[model samples]
Target: MAKDDMDKQPDSVSSVLKVFGILQALGEEREHGITELSQRVMMSKSTVYRFLQTMKSLGYVSQEGESEKYALTMKLFELGAKALQNVDLIRSADIQMRELSRQTRETIHLGALEEDSIVYIHKIDSLYNLRMYSRIGRRNPLYSTAIGKVLLAWRDRHEAEEILSHVVFTPSTARTLTSKEALLSALDKVHSQGFGEDNEEQEEGLRCIAVPVFDRFGVVIAGLSLSFPTIRFSEEGKSGYVKMLHEAARRISEQMGYHSYPF
Candidate 1:
């Protein structure tokens, strides 16, 4: 009986994988009708419709206007936001982020690793005329931004290589690091210096400095960053900004019950 149950587990797991694949396909295509979704998932139309109906009932999927096309519902965002709020790092760092912005008069952001991307969970916008614009819930490439680099730099070498394998280094600007080796070297510097810099790598004319926020186990849980316009701060000024950013991140990590490091 135990052997039979073990053997049946693979079929159950495969069913879950298939459902996840269907959801991924729908997400990639943004919106797809039943026929297209069936073809995309390599499942029959009846099977796809049944699974989609189940998902729709669970609030994970929704139909479009009078059409049979399916799209992800806002329920995912609601769940995700609740999860983020419960994260100790985000809760601990919220006050530090506000303080960082108050002191520097620049935008401060908090991000965490989400699969192959970085998800922004909290932000304090700058009160300036030419501040950068980034939504709180957006995801950005991990290899192209300061906050992403700080999180990546905390990973082991082998894990970093594995994560970088999925990253395509499309140059957002001329200063963007395009080569894997270059990114690796930059990560090394970030690890050594306890901070990272985005010199218009993600956006033109904007500069950002970031530091990792570690958990009680010394593992990176999130990243804190401050962003400003390049025209406002020279290289020396940016370096000073990095110093302040690292200090703020250290305070946040301490508030999160991480006390082992002497930061």
Candidate 2:
């Protein structure tokens, strides 16, 4: 009834504890039978069977047939694999991002395409106090960010179009691309030039340049970018920033097992 009363309920707490116990027992080995699981978790056969059925229906546990033993599905492994990849990616990009920061004294970001949005997975802050303020897990729109554009540009045309189909063309600034056709045209340019640029598109007075980071399969997996303020940006230095970003991204991509860095 009350919050404190709810916390005093032993049944509710025990159910959760029991579920984790069953999962741990299953994790200790391959397949497990209901009776063996019940004994391992110190639960009744009926309770273990019920939890197994529930987990099975949710795709966490699998059984070959009505009489077969249950085993864990690959969903958990897939999630773990994705997390490991991000860890490896961040570790590999750290050195290069620091180098880029030292060379330009601007914010450096490493972002990956996540279902129509770009997520910052790693970053190096600018030396100046007046730099762009951002965090590692911030998500930015794909239509207005240099990292977003570069991540999308290397994709197959049909796939890229499909991905953009769900993206809302919201303008953040006067320079933002507010139409699918306009973004597509810009993407074509990014694909050809091997980089992407944000000229105060996502935010006023901020400029960013990004290059793609490839994976072992030669696929564009991430984008490495440099962020600068308009007051500090110069046309002559743009090429140098692009060159530095490409070199850092190239080394990171190579470490990721992509030897043929296209850009």
Candidate 3:
């Protein structure tokens, strides 16, 4: 809504605005006292204090002592760092993904785990006339995609199981894993081999291979994959393509502050 419309908003919305205003004012300096902050944000001292107390309890704000000033905590900084890392990851992955496209002439995709699916964040189209049909922002089933399998495989066994528990396990193709047990078995292989594959599981006659991209904390935050048609796939070329993907993913992960590449 417009700024003028916001003025006519309900009390809840006004309170939210006041809270954010106070936060913005506090962010301008290292610390702020209740009265000083209230004046800056045009809020009452008691109201500001109430919000500060609530924020402090929530770990968004902190106070040194009962008499000291309120200050913004590291939580906001942590959240911002995560967002920045994702942006940098995509930027770095773009170059590597493009390189892979040139080398193999296949569709390249970078996917991140969302609530219960893998969302494509970036992609490079194949040079050939026959190519995988996919788009950025498309959500693919985690149980049937190479990227999704890699994402799940990198997590703890129990955690991976818990995540799959929420999946409905709808088989998109005849080859798709239709049970949690089967998916878990595939994940075991993915973990052991340090890569994942979709052999006509998501779509008939399509195959995909993916490797994990790690973050600064060495956690798999994304999956990078190459897609191909069965006609274009070769048993001997599988290992070569996997090596290329691993190299690309390693470089991208290193750029994202992860130095130890698993493969």
Candidate 4:
């Protein structure tokens, strides 16, 4: 934007824009002195130095000792790596979720652990009008959902416990596991069985089945799940749905570069 327009923005907004400008300029070179950076971002030397100081303090930029030059840090690259991972995962999961939708005529979801909850990143709606209500970006409790169980099931016991230590186990339904001890037991069962079951724990009359999708390092990065209503769920048919979800998750894990799918 023009300098005049930028000047009219809220001070907080303008400061953020200036910070990004400085960071972008620094990214184009290994290092930059204040004079060069200010010239590149069309800001004054004092403004550039002030932002650089803040960034440096935050570990996003580094200053050469005894020099007036600043450089980008590895911290930004680490943040980008996390975002790029999710992008690649979704790109690879789209076709697989679609194929599962075509065969099962049920809702399919791709979810990943964010903090202590599972967030849906991608979804394919069921072909039937009676399907469950859900959307991408929805957050579901780890103690009550199939995708959530699959996400925590593959983690180390101590790590999983640590992650859940701060969570409030609010029950979503009468069947929901409302305590850490109970949820941890369910996670153990999920780990042993190679899949997870919601069984109306998340929502009354709705059931879900899930399997893990791994990354190149065999880390369980996401969960692939199929949601159904209790009316359509059966002990016999549950096996078939689990089989399909496992196959789909295995292929998705392969697409993410992990070859040895455990299940």
Model 3 spans > 4 angstroms off: 1-5, 9-19, 29-73
Who wins the TM-score comparison? 4
Q: Cα deviation in Å at residue 55, candidate 2?
A: 5.7
TM-score per prediction, in order, is: 0.68, 0.82, 0.78, 0.88
Model 3 / residue 165 / CA error / Å: 3.8
User: On a 0 to 1 TM-score scale, where does candidate 1 land against the true structure?
Assistant: 0.68
**Cα lDDT computed for each candidate against the true fold:** 0.83, 0.89, 0.91, 0.92
> Candidate 3 versus the native: TM-score?
0.78
lDDT of 3 at 229: 96
lDDT minimum window of 10 residues, candidate 2: 1-10
Off by over 4 Å in 1: 1-86
1-263 per-residue lDDT for model 3 (tens digits): 34466568898998798778878887899899988987887667898899999999999999978866999999988989877877898999999999999999999999999888999999999999998889999999999999999999989999988888878999988999999899889898999998999999999999999999998899999999999999999999999999999999999989988899988
* Residues 67-119, model 4: lDDT tens digits: 87899999999989989999999999999999999999999999999999999
> Tens digit of lDDT per residue, candidate 2, span 78-164?
878888988999999999999888888899999998998999999999999997978989999998999999988999989889999
Report, for all candidates in order, the number of backbone clashes: 0, 0, 0, 0
Instruction: Report the candidate with higher lDDT, 1 versus 4.
Output: 4
Q: Give residue 47's error in model 1 in angstroms.
A: 8.7
Candidate 1 C-alpha lDDT tens digits along 124-222: 999787778898889998888998998889899899898888788889889988988899988988888878888889998888888888776788878
